[model samples]
Target: MGKKKSKPAPLPQSLALPYTGVESHAHLDLPPFSSDIEEVLKRAKESGVRYICNVFLGHEAWKNNRHLFEQHDEVFFILGTHPSHVDQCTDAELGAMRAAFAEDSRLRGIGEIGLDYYWDHFPRENQKDIFIKQLHLAKELNTRVIIHSRDAAEDTIDVLETEGFVDYPVLWHCFGGDAELAERIVKNGWYLSIPGTVTYPKNEEAREALKVIPLDRMLIETDCPYLTPVPYRGKRNEPAYTVFTAECVAKELGIDTEELWTTCGNNAIRFFGL
Candidate 1:
């Protein structure tokens, strides 16, 4: 064989930074890294990630897998029923989540809750009902809310505004809209969690949109095992991959990587009250 091309190095291997970056959202409890959870967590820590926020999909997942991160205090939690999974949002489940929040100090917020009009099978009415329930619960607990809206931004904002959530501790998780949408969210005093999708080549809308997101109101997240960033787009994502997102976002904003990374981490810290 002629000259062989060398494989690309992992993002973290080349990304140099202090151990202060926080992964605003992740799903390590998922099955992708079940065999090497320790390695994954260790890799994330070694990659300059200070903490990782694990979002539990529902009460059952939280009840079953919260222990996996018990020894790893750096992994905080946001538990809620996803809009698609409203079937599980029973009164018993709500009571269980409320009890869990009270019993576990690590449960920091209510999240991954809101409208997902992208999926037509799930009725909008049902999604709205459960989302309102969780919003009310978050208000009752006096905790932060992490919203997950997809293709339903108007109604989502309307519902939140009607519920008196403007200026509240709310985060629009996995934000991928245009600059106008970003500006609107900021106007409402809500934070936006930018995901790895911003690194995609064809996502010019998102890349350009990111320019308008205020530094203090922005947070970076892997949303792992889902929107893996560039150079690793075809592979499973993890908290360790947050560096690539930080890199992309920092470049897009024409700011220093370390500065953006630390600022986003601080934003998440303040949002979650960690």
Candidate 2:
């Protein structure tokens, strides 16, 4: 008899939560997905990713692509100037961003705004200034904040504290900090987003950090088109790959996958007020 075809394993499922699964951070509006955004979204939906928080790099990017989000109700935005692009932003641009935040109901927070000392392309002072400005704007609008800190953890924490953002809901996206920093973040009531890098063998530090985070205070994301996880490391990442990152985090915490998924999904919803 001919060999029979085998069915693929079922995708892991999470308990019914307010959200379908959440991609806490991504750049879906980038050029990488411009040609096939619909297919990308379809893959995300099939993988159970119902909500995505897209971070806008700058005012021009937001203005040109904000309409793309309007077509997808599940997609949300975090409008702000990324630290790497701080040099390009001007006072007028910042004012426009403030106005957009006030007018756009889809903007859940101000974010992907923080220190990135790894790249010396722009002066550190400029990055900090823009970051603090956005933090103030977030406070003014009563919105949540998403932070992107790379090689500038201590500075990032200091800025947040100095700006009086400690009391507000903050999401430390793509957290690559050590266990100590993770503890400090959770202690301050901030959420740490586990990225696909956790799936990499060399990212043992991130995995250890994940162990210290309580499920309720933990979130998972692909940080798509960047930190593509294992089995797909060399390719472009998309929202659908968030499942792989979630599975890794669940394994690290020694819990069932569904529990991690539900907890993280609910965490995103509550943090973003979705």
Candidate 3:
């Protein structure tokens, strides 16, 4: 008999949940999706992503692509200099960022800005300086703050505490902290955003942290063009895959996916004032 043909696996279902939640953090302005942003957003919409916050890692990126948000009212922006690109930001840029925040209503928050010791490209002191400046900017504007801390949890916590911005609506984006840190973050009335990493089998730490966070304090994100969830790990991530992260978080917390979806959606809406 002739050899039988094997069928390819189907593309994972897009809208895996009933509710279209917000993609609280993403880099839609990055190069990966520069060619097909419309298609990428269309997929996100089909996958139940009602809103998206396109976080800029540096002032230049924000300047070049700020108009992208104008095409869709559902899309918003958070401006800041990421730790890795802290040196790229200048005094004039900082002033411009503040001015932009004041002028634009769609400028929802300040961040994807925090400590990242994982990469040694920029000096630690410089990163901290820029981070503190933006934190103050967030406070001055009375807007939400989205943080990015990797391998620098202690310093991140210290800066947040010392800076006295814990009272602000802060979201620890792409959180990889342990249960202990999760407790501290929630105790301070801050939020923890679960990324696609939660779906990975080896990410017990993220799942463990998720257990300690109350539903009201939990938000789901893809951190897309990166951190693609399991089953789609090797491929480039997009906002559409946020559902898979939400599903994994729901399973971890022992709740219905719909309930999880609604709670996280509400949490994003409240935190970002969307």
Best TM-score goes to which candidate? 1
Candidate 3 lDDT, tens digit per residue, 1-274? 9999976423435446654588888999989998999998887777777889889776677778888767799998888888888877788888988888878888888887899999867889989998998888888888888888989988998999999976668999998778999999998889988899888999898788888888899888888899999768889999888888887888888888878887898889888887
Q: What is the lDDT of residue 30 in candidate 1?
A: 93
Worst 10 residues of 2 by lDDT: 10-19
Error of 2 at 163 (Å): 1.5
Against the reference, the lDDT scores of all candidates come to 0.92, 0.83, 0.85
- In terms of lDDT, which candidate is strongest? 1
Cα RMSDs of all predictions?
A: 1.3, 3.6, 2.1
Q: What is the number of backbone collisions in each predicted candidate, taken in the order shown?
A: 0, 0, 0
Off by over 4 Å in 1: 1-6
Query: How would you encode candidate 2's per-residue C-alpha lDDT over 50-98 as one tens digit per residue?
Result: 7888888877778889898777999998888888888766889878888
Displacement of residue 217 (Cα, Å) in model 3 is 0.5
Candidate 1 vs candidate 3: which has greater lDDT?
A: 1
